[model samples]
Target: MAIAQSLTTTASLHYTPFIRELFDTLLTDSWCEVSSNRAIEFVEGEADVAVEKLVPYETRSEQGIFFTADDITMKIVNSLAAEVAVEKSFFDPSCGAGNLLLGIAKSYPIKKNLNRTIEYWSKKFGGCDLHDNFVIAAKLRLIALAAIRHGLPSISEGQLASFVRKFDKFYTGDYLEADVGGDFDCVVANPPFGHVVASRSNEWSSGRTQLAAIFVDKIISSGKKGQKLVAVLPDVLRSGSRYERWREKLAKETSCGAVELHGRFSKSVDVDVFILNLNNKPSVVGQIIEWVPPVTDTEGSVRLGDLFLVRVGPVVPHRLEEGDEDFPFLCAKNAPAFGVTFPEERIKFGGTKFLPPFVVVRRTSNPCDKNRLITTLVKGIEPVAVENHLVVMKPFKGGVNSCLKLIKALKDPKVTSRLNNVIRCRHLTTKSISSMVLQGV
Candidate 1:
């Protein structure tokens, strides 16, 4: 059910082996119904595998997991494609059954006849996917859409045969290595997300990298001036400290626009996603990027980073030994919310240790929960070894009194709402916590 559930509205037609078989029969029957030579030839030629293989690689591999939901796909397409003129073009490097590309095509008005329309639109719209079955599905859906849009119950067999040839740009291939020519007006994609093993030589990130992040860099590098890239990327690329350098590099390449948070990709997939809009070229000189979208209600508020020395707890329980039996050890389990906690155990660690009069927030959180930040005050007399799962917020200028005030501010409902917008992922990032804006502090 987990694999089947990953299928979005776009991929709903062919999820299981039985469904794929039906889809295959339907496409073959449609070609026969049209009595078209080229369309039939195209379908038969690309039949490398059986219908069972078309159930999407997402079910089998981490590399090809998570497709964009229908609402999200249409939103990106309509927002970006609406501004594009009829003469302008759109392309998706990793189209994945043409979810985004189909939305783009649907946004445009249908021209003269179905054949002429497909001919003209095919040149304006282009995409490629590594899966051959996905490419076939995309072409089939486009042809079906053309027929429906043209106001016919169905175009006669021969009348729509030319469509199969018109979609020459849609093919089965890897976009990362392919030569993506032409200056497209907009390039939209929901690239795959997961840790990639191979080393990367890109300027944004090197060594082990995320596949989605690498796809973004490749797409940007392939883009021409005046081009726009609208991508649904993992939230970590925006808020994780590991990508801070990548963010810095991205700022120099493209002008960052909107950062819309869409919590948790799917019920099955644990990753959170955000829609990032960027123009390929740097419109402004020396642009300093604001990774998280700024909240508008901060009139008299200041960033938590300015008021506190925010850091993740330095203790890794398995790695450290009991050096001082008398020292206290504090972890999330024993750190009660809104209550004072004293470390009871000790660890032999040479890393940063926190003293009392500091606030501790649980690093793991859920946006769907009633409270996003679970806070506790540590007011012991001795230094404590805090577990890595808790984020320690030590006031820079304010001592014990400041810690109490900070706790009060964090308890506000507005703080929870704001933090939800800042980082939707389950694990709260240190950078995101630091970026938290506190009111009346």
Candidate 2:
């Protein structure tokens, strides 16, 4: 209980301690069942110690428990709620501190009867979290929201226990295995991004992926036709080459809705995130939605994938030992940007080598960069080993002149805009590069 107390004490700073004293008073009044059911207890001794003096105990980043800022939470909820009818029946599988649930509750028009409103919405919204404290906090926040709207001075012990009992649908459990029933119309979540070992017997799961993917996949499988889903997910799920199959499968099962990019999760978290909307009604089955492909008005435009044998450089510098320097080795550091150059360095490796008269694009990219594709024409007569951090695009039509034309084509402003739209993560993907059209070439 000490660990739980400290975790709550810390979480309160981020979520605000508006209800901390109320909760402490309520729990001290012997409302222990609400806080201890199926709970994971913490070390007993630390509850008496000051929380600030101790190193912050964070749930592993893989748990994806980064609490959404109030502004961002409201934005996510508002964006999703705008698309569909104002429905009260909603659920958050990984409900952390009830940020998302409170956003939904606020969407309803103010009702005059506070008790009825609190009682009704409590059952209308369904949610589950692995942590008992989060579930308790979510219920309390919902009740407090009602109290604030109606201007109640205080809730008595009996009234507090009554409201807590009404939130029967919100419980503690693993979302992937829990059965939330078919009562909810909208399923909303910010599921964990960490990889989990999915149940091998489940047909919907394909072994390893971010937990967010698994959560969405399970919802799609169990959801009724026309059921709504709104989730905040990592940008990598949108653009990474590794998730292409995931996108394809999702497209096959659900209708394409919308993808709204929100730059960076927050000031503290480095990952970029986006809001995704979907439904069980499949309209564009098996057809991936082009979330943001560069629009074109010109004729005879073709994808670069159609022209070049584009692939990531095969050499992983750190994994291999420095053996005989048999081939010229090129990497992001040695490869000059926007210029043609040859490297004298060589490395020992038995892998695919790119010949001279090809283009090497640095894979390290940021959305804020002036040019998303940092290009260089590697000119030489002999084939050389390129580091995996660079993507190699060998022309199929001609030689060095084709490489030059490709490099020049990449310099176009439209290409930069298009690349930024295709992928915003720190690293570029071969899939995104290959998908870029040879515009203005």
lDDT of 1 by residue, 108-198 (tens): 7677887777888788778877765566566665665565566433444344445656788775677878877336788888888867754
For every candidate, C-alpha RMSD to the true structure in Å? 6.8, 6.9
Looking at model 2, report the run of 10 residues with the lowest lDDT sum: 38-47
Number of backbone clashes in candidate 1: 1
RMSD (CA, Å), candidate 2 to true, equals 6.9
Error of 2 at 357 (Å): 1.9
List model 2 lDDT by residue over 291-380, tens digit each: 665467468666888778898888887786455448888998999988888877887877778888788888887776788888888888
